[model samples]
Target: MQRKKIAVIGIGSFGKLFVQYLFEDGHEVIAIDKDPVIIDSIKDSVTIAVALDATDEHALISQGIADVDYAVIALADDFETSIICAESLKKCGVKNIYARYQTPLQMKVLELLGIKDLFNPEERAARSMAETFSFSGMRSSFLLSDDYSVVEVTVPKRYINKTIAEADLRHKYNINVITIKRPITNKESKRASDSKGEKILGIPHGNTLLREDDVVVLFGSQSDITRFLES
Candidate 1:
């Protein structure tokens, strides 16, 4: 991904994590919040942490907020503050503004403010909890046991179109591929994903070709698999 300068307004729990992840992805993140203590807590994790009122348009512009490529308003608990921060961002000419909303009405209001990106943390958290309680085919996505795990993910971009042996995932990342599934063209199907052509390429050999659309089942130490996907 191309690195860009981004600003995160609100150094609460939600914004703190958002800044951390974006910074980890090699982006220059500017952390903004009104609380000096909150800003100090996250200062080391970001490129810069500013203790300023994000609602003030002048204060934001003084920090060169207009030059930022994107800004996220993560003041979920304080909806009023969130709206004001968004207005400041808009006036500063930020092209991308991602806001957090706790309810449908809040989402609508943010939409009216010209924010195309809005998220509901409570709704997402509820959905995630429900999924965790149910039996999912993709449950192998997590730890099957303490020591090992099974994961199903699409072939990495660097590994697409390469033979299994060529990728050398087992040698480099210590993860072994257990199965592969690829869609076969069906003229009557509306989309390739709905073709009902799921076939388990059981016991894949070194010569097996990895396609762009292939989903592979892998088994290995969770840490190793994570390294492989991140690599």
Candidate 2:
């Protein structure tokens, strides 16, 4: 993957983690924060740590942020500061911009500035926690829309060795199996038993067979997923 220079405009908890991950993944990162303590804490980890108000376009340009490939405004508490930083970055020709917003008003402001990717970290965290607590068997779940949800479920023992056409997931359960993950073993092994030991988990094709312990990631409505789970 081609590494790009990324700038994170806040050194709060979420911003700090994002910067650390980018740096660890070999991407050049510029860390900016108004707090001297925050800048001091992450100075050694990032490519550049600047202690300046990101709301000021002049200060941001002076800190060499105009040349960054991607800029992320992650100041959750201050909506005005986030908007200013995003607007300035857009005017400076930064192509990729992400911002964290706390409310719908803040999201609308960012949208007006042509920033497409907006995240609410608090809401995401809460949704994740709620999913984990409510569903014990679910591996993961995503809210695609108000009425739709996507979820991953392990195929039960009763559904083993049944082809997709025979199982009729869509007709029976109103769900679509998007993909199936299968484990691959080394082919160069000498043991014939090892070669035959590989098992089919969940076959996703029309003629495919479903087996026990196979995980099926499916997309469907919240009501449909709940109905399938109950059955």
Candidate 3:
């Protein structure tokens, strides 16, 4: 993969983690924050750390923000500042821009400014955690729309030895399995004994029966998932 340059504005907890992940993934990162202390804390971790107000378009451009492949604004406390930074980044010709907003009104303002991706980390985390309580065996779920969700659920022991056709998953639960995560041997192994080693021995095949420990990734309506779980 081609290494990409990324610029992150507001070195708050969220922004700091995001930049760190980008850098760890082999991307060049430019960290910007109004607080000099915050920039200094992450100076060694990032390619460059700048202490400048992201709301100031000229100052951001001067700090090489315009040359980045992607820009992220994660100023949670100041919505206006986040919007200003987003707009400034857009005007600077940054191709990919991401911003965080707290409320619906703030989201609307960001949308009006032509910001395509707006995230609310708190809300997202809450929603994800809520799914575990609502559905038994659910590890995570994503709301695609008001009526639809993509969910991950562990196949119960009762469902073992049932074929896709026999289970009638679509007709009974209105859920579609998109993919199965079958574990493969690690390619980095050097020894033949290591290659032959039974590391958590199991085979995942489409025609093979589902097991108690197998995780199923399904996509369907929330109502369908609820009803399926109830049955």
Candidate 4:
């Protein structure tokens, strides 16, 4: 994964997780919050953790917000503060901004300000959980748009031992397999052991054979994805 310099404003519960994930992904994370205690708790985990008001444009610039590749406004419950921080980030020339909004009004306000990449993580999580529960093999799912989605589905028994070309996924189900995530064999003296003592296989190609216990990343309409998973 490519490392990104990210500025996460308002290190609340949601923001803290966001920062931690980015830090763990090997990105340079600047975790900003108003509470010194919060900063202190997360400082050791991230690249930079500062207790400062996010609405202050000067403070944001001082912390190198302009140089960051991405910025996230994580003040979901604090509507005014979230908007103000987003404005400050844009003014400081942060190109990509993602924000969390609690209510429809907050979403509208952010949309009006041209911040289109707004999300409600709680709602999304609930939806994903519901989808996974409804689909037996669906591990996780993300709705990219009204019609499109990216879904992670376990390779069904019928697909085991089939090559990507033999599966005929696109023509049969209208879904595209972006990549396959196969579990690594637990052998001693292996090169790719993860920190958790597990390893994932590399991205697969057309000639690659599908195996049981593999997770495939599929991109297509929700209906098509459902059909493929069900098939």
Candidate 5:
């Protein structure tokens, strides 16, 4: 997927996950919130995490929010502030925008700004929420334990061009490569020419070869997965 620049205004529970999932998708995400503590919590996961008033147009412009491909405003309880932020985003020339609203009036205000993409806050369970985000390599996460997580990650450079049998992920990293998401290729005696889409190569066998662009869905402890990806 192409990397997009996105500005997310608000750092509450839902907004934090939105930023995390976007970042995990390999997008350049700018996380904006007024609370310093909230900003600090999310700083490591985003391209930029700033504690600033989103309603301030000058501040938004200075942060280059206008140049981002999209912006999401999700001030959970503050519909008025969200409204102001929408206007500020408009002034900054951000075209593609999405917002969350609590009430009917909040929806109407956002709709008036040409923001048709609005979502209502839904009550979600923890595990279900994680599962929802995990599909894009886990915008949601598959947390088997506090120590273990089933994660989808790109193939390490060292593993590229090697067969799964040779890489020995199971032995070396203690991680199971359950499947591989690879670019759809035309059949020419296994000639992998790029198509415009990707498909999951179900149940990779020992002979399955790894590619530079392959995203491997693996299951393991968090520490082991970290080691696998980092090394």
Candidate 6:
């Protein structure tokens, strides 16, 4: 894995996870929070853990955040603090800034400030839950936008053994099959082997056949995905 210099502001639950993931990925992580307890808790887990006010631009610059490859503002349930942290990161010349906001209105404000990447965990979870409840065949779903989603669905019995071209998914349902994941049985393994499960077969070709146990990854608008799954 290529190592990256990442700075995370606000050592809340989400921020801690962000630091953990980056650090586990073999990247250099700098964790910042106002609370000494939070900073101390995550100190050993990251490259650097500092108890500092993220809203202070001078402090951010002094910490050499301007040289980081990416900076994330993970202030939870606090839009004002998020905005100040984002402003401080921008002033420090951090090129890539990812900010997490609580509401749609906060998203708009962040967008106006030229922050392209935004994360709203609560909203995403709610949307995914709604989709799961609405569609029984949907194993898992991810929202790309308000109208678009990527869903993993069980192949309907009617489409089993059918080729991709025969299904005409794009024309009939306005969805595209990104790839196919098929369970591969390992005779040499024990009853509960982790590697005895499904694995991606890369991008499928036009003539790729759909098997009975094949899990397909589909991408399209929400309505189209619903239509495809329901059929």
Q: Which number leads on lDDT?
A: 6
Which lDDT values do the candidates have, in the order given?
Answer: 0.83, 0.81, 0.80, 0.86, 0.83, 0.89
lDDT of 6 at 215: 88
lDDT of 1: 0.83
TM-score leader: 6
Candidate 1: the clashing residue pairs are: none
What lDDT score is found at residue 73 in candidate 4?
87
| Per-residue C-alpha lDDT of model 4 across residues 1-231, encoded as one tens digit per residue | 889998888888888888999999999999999999999999988999999999999998899899999898888667888888988888999989998888888889999999988888888778778889998888899988657889888888888999988998989998888888766655564465542242355566788898888888889998888777666
Error of 6 at 192 (Å): 4.0
Tens-digit per-residue lDDT, 1-231, candidate 3: 799998888888888898898889999999989899999999989999999988888998797777888898888898878877777887888889988889889989988988878788888778868887877888788877557888877776677768666677888888887654433465688975665332232333457566556677778888898787778
Instruction: Put the candidates in TM-score order, highest first.
Output: 6, 4, 3, 2, 1, 5
Model 6 TM-score, all chains together: 0.85
Clash pairs detected, candidate 6? none
Q: Residue 57 in candidate 5 has what lDDT?
A: 92
Q: What range of 10 consecutive residues in model 1 has the weakest lDDT sum? A: 131-140
Q: Which stretches of candidate 1 lie over 4 Å from their true place?
A: 140-231
Candidate 2 per-residue C-alpha lDDT over 143-222 given as tens digits, one digit per residue, 9 for 90 to 100: 76557877877776667788778878899889998876544566887986675333444545788767666677789988
Q: How close is every model to the real structure, measured as TM-score?
A: 0.62, 0.70, 0.77, 0.84, 0.55, 0.85
- Model 5 Cα lDDT, one tens digit per residue, 1-231: 999999999999999999999999999999999999999999999999999988889989989987999899978988889989988898889999889877788778788878887876562245537554543333234665557777766776777999999999899989898899886655544433443467899999999999988888888887887676556
In each prediction, how many residue pairs overlap at the backbone (N, C-alpha, C within less than 3 A)? 0, 0, 0, 0, 6, 0
lDDT tens per residue, model 1, 164-228: 99988889999999989876766798986776676788999999999987888889986787677
RMSD of 1: 15.6
